[model samples]
Target: MIQDNIDTTTRQPIYPLLAAFAASCLLGTLATDIVYWWTADIIWADFSDWLVSAGVIVGWVTVIVALIEIFALRSARFRQRSRAYASAMVLALIVIALILATIDMLVHTRDAWTSVVPWGVILSAAVAALVLVTAYLSRITDAPAAIEVTG
Candidate 1:
């Protein structure tokens, strides 16, 4: 019995988890903005503010980890699993989301009603859309690679 070239190096799952969490928070912020718009409540605005802040922070962490993975610890298996173009697109989308979320966080600092009524809500929606697209691209990029064993 012979053992072949089986690479057992497993990549950390923290980046993807953080990415998803950040996306969830950002998307939830959009929902809160909608609720605030419908109800004209200050509490909903506060929720949106906190959510966007958290999302931006977590998104930064996700981006840092992704950058490290891309430049520092890119294993052959990871390269095999991901298409270079798709991975680049995912990173680009995440960065775009981060920028939008940062802007949204600043917008949240305005008066409660005015904060989330228009610009805040619009930024939230844009960030949410970017994160959703990032998540989709990440999923496709992480699909298991087809192993071709030749003798």
Candidate 2:
């Protein structure tokens, strides 16, 4: 049978996971904006910065989760799975980088928009990439490898 001949338990594709993550980020952005807008009047102190930082933390958390999935949960023998997870992580980092870059750009010019490169984003991407590279070099858990090995 086809089912018997081919591997049935296939690893999930990374793009959809990324899409879902992006959606979550967008929703989160909106939610945070709304929440802060609603509370802008009553909240003590400017906690918007804290909330923005929280977004960054959430993104990093995604990276950790993906790394765990690749290293701890999946079998090391399946390099494909590991690679997939790694790729997922990389994509996630890229998304986060874009977000930060956008934020930087927006911040640079409050009234007008600019397409300046986000040094912070680049630094973060580099760090994230290095993490994955180090982990790969170290051969940490052999296999979603999504949560960014990069984050």
Candidate 3:
């Protein structure tokens, strides 16, 4: 049964969001490959570059979401959009990329723990945790205020 609540009216759909992310990542990979192919003349030469491509996917999503909020939030069905959710997702992708970059950096050297990108991973983890907390808090705040209808 559908709860005919205003909050429900504006709630984000999970499956569609996941699909958007997947589609966007695929597009990002294709785009990165095409660009690299044109300039570097190498096809699928840099597989790890897909990590950065994932970041680009999330980045494009953030931009599109922001523009929607700026121009159409009032009119949109999902007016109560998860702004923090979007931001946190992008940050999470960056953190993943940072982690991968750290691993990549370690691959080129003998020492693993003594690299610089690991420090970046640590910092990115901290930031990602913070963003996740913020997203949680924002979701809480976006909830409609309770009212007491005392008779």
By TM-score rank, best first, the candidates go 1, 3, 2
Q: Where is model 3 more than 4 Å wrong at Cα?
A: 1-53, 73-116, 143-151
TM-score for candidate 2: 0.33
Quote the lDDT for 67 in model 2: 49
TM-score of each: 0.83, 0.33, 0.34
Off by over 4 Å in 1: 1-10, 77-82, 143-151
Error of 2 at 64 (Å): 1.0
Question: For residues 1-151, what per-residue lDDT tens digits would candidate 3 score against the true structure?
Answer: 3444554445443322432453344334434344444455343324324533454345455545544543444323224366444544544554454354344334323232322233423433343344345345434544211111111
The lDDT per prediction is 0.76, 0.41, 0.39
Over 4 Å off, model 2: 1-23, 26-51, 75-78, 81-92, 95-151
lDDT of 2: 0.41
Model 1 Cα lDDT, one tens digit per residue, 62-86: 7887666555655444455446666
Report residue 131 deviation for candidate 2 (angstroms).
Answer: 19
lDDT of 3: 0.39
Per-residue CA lDDT of candidate 2, range 39-95, in tens? 543231123333334445555555555446455655334456556655555555545
Best by TM-score: 1
